[model samples]
Target: MTNKDVYIAKMKMQLDELDGQMSVLEARAKEAKDDARAKYEEEMAKLHEQSKLAQGKLDSMKSATAEAWDATVAEMEKVRDAFVHSFSYFKSQL
Candidate 1:
């Protein structure tokens, strides 16, 4: 379909995958030992915050008009990329 449509679909898919990853990370954090658990919880908390930010961006993107779609996508991607990067690094730790 259109660029806006494609972008929106892609972003939604990415967000879904990111949500699943967050859950996986959450479970892993819960499984850690006492000392490591504290650190994991801190990291997970930061990740949760990032997830919220990304979700907000996604919501904005969904409601954005054609004229504003590009800008919204750019902003959404920034937050999505940060979440992906952080999740990748966090996964490596486990």
Candidate 2:
């Protein structure tokens, strides 16, 4: 398979894993104490926004022309990095 195909497959797996992480965050939030729950809800909102941004980047990558593939991958990587960092930071706070 082509490099782009491999990258897309890898990224799809990571994105799926990120979705699972978000679900775990939601469940933890539900179990949080009152004030902590509010905080978790607030931070989780931002995480969801980041996740949406990542998904958008992923969608763009999926349809990108071969000539534009590298640039799309670069942008996707930035989004993925931000999403991961934010998720880790927020999870640590819990």
Candidate 3:
């Protein structure tokens, strides 16, 4: 595969793994107290929005031209970083 292809594959895998971890967190959130569950749901909603943005970026990347690949990758990384940071903070609170 080309470098771009490899990078896309790696990112897709990472996103999948992150999604799985988020699922586990969702289950844990359900077991929390009412107040805590409310907070967890709010954070989860933000994460889900970020996840959707990242997925949209990935879809764009797949169709990107060679000239646009780098820009698309950069955008994807920013979204990924934000998602990861948010996830980490939420997990710590749990």
Best candidate, lDDT: 3
Per-residue lDDT over 1-94 for candidate 1, one digit per residue giving the tens place of the 0 to 100 score: 9777787788888888888888988898899899999988888888889888988888888779979877887888889999989988888887
Q: How does residue 78 of candidate 1 score in lDDT?
A: 89
Candidate 1 TM-score, true structure as reference:
0.88
Pairs that collide, model 2: none
Cα misplacement distance, residue 33 of candidate 2 (Å): 1.3
- The CA lDDT of each predicted structure is 0.86, 0.90, 0.92
Error of 2 at 43 (Å): 1.0
Q: Which regions of candidate 2 deviate over 4 angstroms?
A: none
Better-scoring candidate (lDDT), 2 or 3? 3
Give the better candidate number (1 or 3) by TM-score.
3
**Which residue pairs clash in candidate 3?**
none
Q: Stretches of candidate 1 above 4 Å error?
A: none
Q: Model 2 shows how many backbone clashes? A: 0
Q: Where is the poorest 10-residue window by lDDT in model 2?
A: 54-63
Clashes of 3: 0
lDDT of 1 at 26: 87
* RMSD, candidate 3, Å: 0.7
